[model samples]
Target: MTSTNDSNKAAPRKSGPSRRGAMKTIAGAAAALVAAPYIRPASAAPTALRALMWEAYAVRDVIGAFEEKHKVKFAPTFFDGNSEAYNKLRVGGTKDFDLVQADGFWPSLYFREKLIRDMDYAKIPGTANYFPAFKPDAFPLLKDETSGVFFGVPFCWGSYGITYNVGEVPVEKAKSLELLFSPDYSGRLATNARFEENIALAGIMVAHRMGTIDKPRPDGKSFNPYKLTDEELDGVEKLLIEQKPLLLTRYQDAATLEQLLVSGAIVAAPEFAQVYRLMLEKKAKGELDITVDHTLKPKEGGLGWVDTWLISSGVTDAEKADICHAFIDTMIKPETMVQIGKASGCSTTIDIRLLSSAEDQVLYLMNRTDELRGMYMFDQPSSTEKWERVWSRVQAA
Candidate 1:
């Protein structure tokens, strides 16, 4: 995600400029209302509701109809990264914002720290329409085991995989992370600037080499790529050091990566689905002639994330709480998800019903649930400070 603070951020839409980029309007307020069971028309809803979320969710199309329907103002602040949003809430306290959006594992941290409130699944009835994979049983971190309550609701998700220019890299080669490190693609390759993902990507190969990629952690859960042991961390650092010189650049923004891909300066990189979509947009405009495709089921399995909406513990008023639930419910509605999916082109919505066309499903990998099952969801490492030091050393190396 590009920093909201950057001056060179992507240009916004003329209709409604967001904090970072164009804010496309979401259609079908009537459809959303029809699907939403918890929402009740308000004669005098709260004057304003505050949110701290990704820039994508702050657009008028997403909240405009809800605002118009309930007669409430939507006040949102955007963050480029989850840690930024989490730290802001920690410093400012939950009272500063009514609702917050976080990625896969942060909600668990919020729950552990009591930064967010447990929400009743009954209030957000639209969740019932979500794909079965999104249920609490599949992602236990978002739900409390004892209370059977949810700390957050997932809105959009996608995987971080090897994105390659199909014209240059063959499909079979692109199906593995090994392509990124190939000597032929060395100077023609790039990687994400974020170290955590880099670590995970490298760790996957290292774990596999050590024949421990499938081994469960002490908790008996799936193997955690982020929570590397000292030996694994050393292996990851060595892998990154070896990978450092074989790059055109380490990109921090999607625009830079897109330009590199379109210009053919780089043949491939580890990137999110959104970057590939942006490249497609460029392709549509006759900006590039090359075909592009991302590895959906990389040999190491891709690193993925689900961004979710969580209400702050500070929202004590029943009326305000209900409004937050309504907002979440509106976001998960099939019609709303479709519009959001179209506008973003990167993040996949949680509802499979919105994907009626086989083309849409295949293009977005919406029908590939088994592949998603093989993915490693992004999460906080057991020792973030340790990871940071390792990352710093790799960069300095």
Candidate 2:
């Protein structure tokens, strides 16, 4: 099986304006207009907060709540993936936004590169309510234990698994990752275009089926089943290459993949739990016939992911401290978290009792700690390049 522990870093691309750059420009202009001390200072207008995040996450109700409570308008931009968001920010320049929703693993790279500013915790009183594990300090970025200093706040989290169409693959036979890359269903298979999670899933499946484990370096910290060895890598590579002729398309978005599945053009694909839930809904309505399954990959581990909210370093200290905190508080409320979970079709770290009956399944899957730990976080920087190479070969075939 392909090892999921490969590097998680994407090759930094020159994307666009960062939040910091935008703030600096605004600050410079404001400073230029200032006169003598005797002159009364102009009261700053309430700033319009702009955010770039997942489409479902930028809910109008959530933004409206913040706007009404804080008396500031919020404008949000949406992106399908973190890399797209990062690239937009890099190329667009910093002045375009006040906040960016990022995954936990990618924020470390952004923080190290100074793409975002350390948050002013004092203003955001809501930071206190977060679970310790979700704290930015818990990540590798902040080496110290300062309570309020953070680059991001926890947003939502979900796990990776094979989401197959039951109409195509029977339950008993489809209970493993093997079905995803099996030659029998190659031309009908679909996969996410996102490199990290896709590659990790592929790696784990390849490693396990080959009877090998790919161990972490040095201290040998590793997960169950075991790691993949050199021979296993070769075998996994061959398996993936052979299966290439069967793939229908390299999906870059879930909506498209879901639509394809609904149309019966694709049989089985590796995807987030959210997509599976949607498929389940369609199946229930009789508009589609499908089965949602989370097969256990015995040897190869699954992929794990976390989403977070980060304050733009460029925002005023006063705004960052107060508004950001308020936002966090608003999101963590049991009712609010439930709404978020239901709308996004993903489980969150917050307690699930707060959610409605509709969200029970998603909440259950997300909170499965034992199952979650078995999945791999996309923390490796080199994995993307490697996956791209593999993907190219797959496409070429």
Candidate 3:
């Protein structure tokens, strides 16, 4: 679900992918399929895209519509988290999946490792509408520095940050990340058990406080909040140890965090905007009389995840590969994206202009995000083995 912005609007090409640059040709069939509105049923046999994805992302209606129009099938396999999916793809081998709906950081596993094939942007003409952050050359994960080939197309996105009960924590204090680890709130704090997320937030807060707040590492420099270096891990781990005394418990999903918040088992901790959306629905339904403050981000910035669509290296067949390209096109459509936003509270990457017409549930996402500022996408590190060792210690502690 790449985004469309009002900035530098390219002339509409009713035909197909723009002649913006010399495009690569992965497979001859890809050319016909992209310009093709629907794959002709008689000529080519149907192929199934073994989609490794999340339950929320692969909405039934959207999948059904795509399956019907293209005469293709989707064999979905859901994973609990990005880390697990990364392993499944790695262990199972790349060729097993036709496509994987993994977090944006998946470039660390796919592109660098050469587990996936370089994509033909020309095939997915809709990519011209993606956010600047999503475009090739924007990040290492999206494009290869050496070949300048794009390995992934951004699909869906969501923000992660501290959520606090306004009744318990003052708005002034709620804005700070320190509130999450504050002793004053000890025994009342809760966090997602996702190792990287908890540790990333801790690292950012410490770096911001210690005046080492250099994120969005320019020139492809090493210091990254999502994937810490040995030195950065030391700082991150120390902060986690400090916060463990304050954390009531660690959680697995939004529902668990929601129950913890509602039961008064916790007051403040890290959460996704999706969970915040749920709390709002509960408030409107009179299920609870509590106000939650999720907007006020850590002055340093927060982390987010942008899941993208990538084809496995094993998908060399022209027919199957074309299907993957067609699926990417369908995913970015404004109508299809709106449906995804409606089904999953996560933000849809579509034309920002369409935000006005979106439902309250969809518009609710705007307030919780600050993509232009104070937000960084989650990432897998270059030295993930090094990062994982530190992360394990943080979790064990």
Candidate 1: RMSD to truth: 16.4
Worst 10 residues of 1 by lDDT: 19-28
Which digits, one per residue and each the tens of the lDDT, describe model 2 over residues 86-180? Answer: 78777753446667777736776666656667765555455554444554454433322343346766667766667777767887657677777
Candidate order, lDDT descending: 1, 3, 2
Question: Which is the winner by lDDT between candidate 1 and candidate 3?
Answer: 1
lDDT (CA) for every model shown? Answer: 0.80, 0.64, 0.73
| Per-candidate clashes, comma-separated | 3, 37, 2
The best candidate by lDDT is 1
TM of each candidate vs. truth: 0.84, 0.74, 0.79
- Which wins on TM-score, candidate 2 or candidate 3? 3
| CA shift of 164, model 1, Å | 0.2
1-397: candidate 1 lDDT, tens digit per residue: 3576464466654675664442223335656766664344665456788899887655577788899998898989888777678789899659779999888688988988889998877899888875677776676768887777889887887888888999899999999888877888879999988877888889888888887778776667767887777888899888889888789999988889888988899999988788887666667679779879888658876788888899999887788899999999988887788777766665554665445566567666676654656688887777879998999998889
Candidate 1 vs 3: which has more TM-score: 1
